[model samples]
Target: MTIEARFRIDRGSFTLDVSLSIPARGVTSLLGPSGCGKTTLLRAIAGLERCHDGLLKVGGVIWQDGRRFLAPHQRPLGYVFQEVSLFDHLTVVRNLEYGIKRVPKSEHRVSLNRAIELLGIGHLLERAPGTLSGGERQRVAIARAVAVSPRLLLMDEPLAALDPSRKQEILPYIRSLHQELEIPVIFVSHAPDEVARLANHLVLLEAGRVVATGDIQTMLTRLDMPLAHDSDAAAIIEAVVTGHDENYHLTHLDFSGGRMTVTGNAMRTGDRVRLQIAARDVSLTLERQSDTSILNIFPATVDAIIDEGSAQVTVRLLAGDVPLLSRITKKSAAELGLEPGKPVYAQAKSVALLT
Candidate 1:
C-alpha cells in the first residue's frame, strides 16, 4: 500500500509543487532544510492545508480529489506538533482521554492501555500537564495521539522544542512506535541524525519540490546526493545481533557486508538493530591490517569517488552488497591508487547503534 500525494500551493514568492508516492509503512520522513515546505507537505497530507489542485490517497482510499475533499476533522489522522499543546487544566490521562473521545469507540484500534504502555507513560497518567517535564509532556502527547488509533500519525518536528537531553529521553519511545504499532508515520525534520535514526523511507525535498525518494539506506549513501557530501554523512546498515561475548561485553551484529562487534551486550541475540557508520570514521587500506585497534574491517570494492574541497575526497564502496563510505585525503587516494572496482579494506573507528 502507498500514500499518493500531489499538491501545488502558491503564496506570494514561494510555491510548493510536488507529486510523490510514499510507502504506507514504517516512518517516512520528509527531510530538507527549513522553509523547504516539509511541514506544508505534511499539512496537506493531513487535509489541514487545502489545495485546489491537490490529490491525496492513503492505502488506496481517496481522501481528496477534484470534487471530493475531506476536511481536517474528517481525516483519520493524529497530528503532534512541536509544542506539547496539552491543556494546562487537564491531567496526562485526561489529555489522552480527550483524544480518545474524538474517535468512535468502534474505530479504536489502539487501546488506551496499549498507548500508555507503548510510550512508557503509565506513571505520569495522573500528573497535570504543567507538573510534567518537557519530555514527559511530549510522551503524553504522543500517547494521546496513539490512543486515537488513527490510521496515520503525523509529527512536525515533535522534538524541536525540547533541549538536547530531553530530545534524547523521548527518541527511544518514538522508535518503539515504529516497532510496536502498525500505523504509518509521517515525520518532518531537518535534522539528519533524527532522520537517520527514525526514518525507514526518505523523501528529500528541495525548495518545495521532491529531489529524491527511496529507502533510507540507499538515499543516505548515494554519492550523487548532497547527503554524501555533508560533514556528518553516514551509512545506515541493518544488522541482526548474532551473539554476545559475556566476558568481553561486546555484541556481534551481522549484516550483508559482514559481522560488526560493538562495545555493549545490552541487545539480545537475534534482535535486529540499525548501525550508523559515519564517513569520517572510516579509513581505507590496501590490505587487511590485524594490528589496529579498530575491530570493524570489511573488504570492499570502490564504487565511486568525489572530491570534497581540494584536499580530500569521498569514496563510495560496496562491501558485499552493502554500501559504505569513506572520507580520505587526496594524497591518500593517490598513494593507494584507488579507483572504481579496486579492492580495499574499510576500517571503521566507531559505529553508533541507532536502534
Candidate 2:
C-alpha cells in the first residue's frame, strides 16, 4: 500500500476517527470544513500529533502502529504548510540546502538544481526569503521540501495564505509536480474548485470522520454525498475540439453531443480537453431554443428531483444517463412543471475548460 492511516484520537471534546488508504501516486485531497480535523489528521499521519490509536504507513513502510511510532524527523516526508516558514535570516539557497544537507548524499534522489528548477526559483536563490514576494517565498518553501527527496508529500492548504494572483501563479507549478514527480502528495483543502482542479482522488471528511472517498468526478456526482448539493456541483466531461469558427473565435467540443461552443480557449482541432459546467450554469428548457443567444444546448431527461431547501431544487439529469446536475429554484420547477420523464434542453451559461 502507498499510504495507510487509521486514526482515532480524542482530545477533550474533539474526537477524530478516520481510516484511509490512499494510492502512492497522483494527488489525493483531504477535503472538509474548518475544525473538521483535516489538519489534525495530517499531523497524526506525519507523527507530529500523537494519537492513542493509530497505524500510519507510506510505501508499505510502517511509520506508526499502536506499539511503535516514528518521530516526525524520522519519517521521509516533504511538508509544506500555509506559512512560508523559511528562515528569515537565511538566503533561499541555504534554506533549501538546510534539509537537502540533512539527508546523506547517497540518499539524495533529487538534486538541489532539480528542486529549484521544479519550483522555478532559480533567480531567487541568492535573495533572502524576506525579500521575496508571498508566491516566491512559497515556491522556495516547496523547493526546500522537494530537496529532501521525501517518500511522501503532505501539504496543508499551501495556497491559503497567497493572494488570488499569487495562487494562480503557483498553480501551474503544482500541476507540473503532479505530472512529472514520482512522489505521491496528500493535500488538505476546503475549496471545491481547488479539489476539482488539482485532486485525482478525494477523501471527504465531515465531523472528523471519513464520509466519502472516490475519484473527483464520482464524488461530485454521487447523489448520496453532499457534494452533489453544492452550488458549484456539476460534471466533468471530456471533449475534443471538433471545429472552430474563424469569425467568432469560438471553439466547438464534441462529446456525446456533436458540438458545444464555449467562450474562451484557442483550442486547436482535435485537441482533447475537459470541461467543468456548474449545476447552476445549466438551465432546462422543454425544447431547443432558436431565439436565445445560448449556443450549447443538449437533450436531457430528468432522472430525480431533490429538494435542496425551501427555495431550490436539485435535478439529476441524464444525457442518455450521463449524469449531469442542474439547480433550479423550487418555485421555478413548479412553474415549469418539471419531473421524471421530462425531456428538456440543458442550456449552459458558461463552460470552464479544465487544463
Task: Return the top candidate by TM-score.
Answer: 1
Candidate 2 — worst ten consecutive residues by lDDT sum?
A: 256-265
lDDT of each: 0.92, 0.86
Q: Which regions in candidate 1 have their CA more than 4 angstroms from the true location? A: none
Question: What is the per-residue lDDT of model 1 for residues 1-355, given as tens digits with 9 covering 90 to 100?
Answer: 9999999999778899999999999999999999999999999988888897799999999999998999988989988988878989988899999979888989988999999998889999889899888888888999988889888999999999999888888888888886888889999999999999999999999999999999998899898899999999999999999998899999999998988999989998999899999999999999999998999999999999999999999999999899988999999999999999999999999999995
lDDT of 2 by residue, 1-355 (tens): 4688999988878889999888888889999999999999988888889985699878878898878888999999999987879999899999999999899888898899998999999999899888999999999998899889988888889899988889888877876775777778889999887777788789999889999888776777777889999877977776899888878888888887446898655878898777888899889988789899888788988878888878999888877646778899998889888988898889988888866
- In order of listing, the candidates' clash counts read 0, 0
lDDT of 2 at 93: 92
Q: Against the true structure, candidate 1 has what lDDT? A: 0.92
Off by over 4 Å in 2: 104-109, 238-243, 254-259, 267-274, 318-322, 331-344
For all the candidates, what are their Cα RMSDs to the real structure?
1.2, 2.8
**Candidate 2 global CA lDDT score:** 0.86
Using lDDT, give the best candidate's number.
1
TM-score of each: 0.97, 0.87
Once model 1 is optimally superposed onto the true structure by TM-score, how far is the C-alpha of residue 38 displaced, in angstroms? 0.7
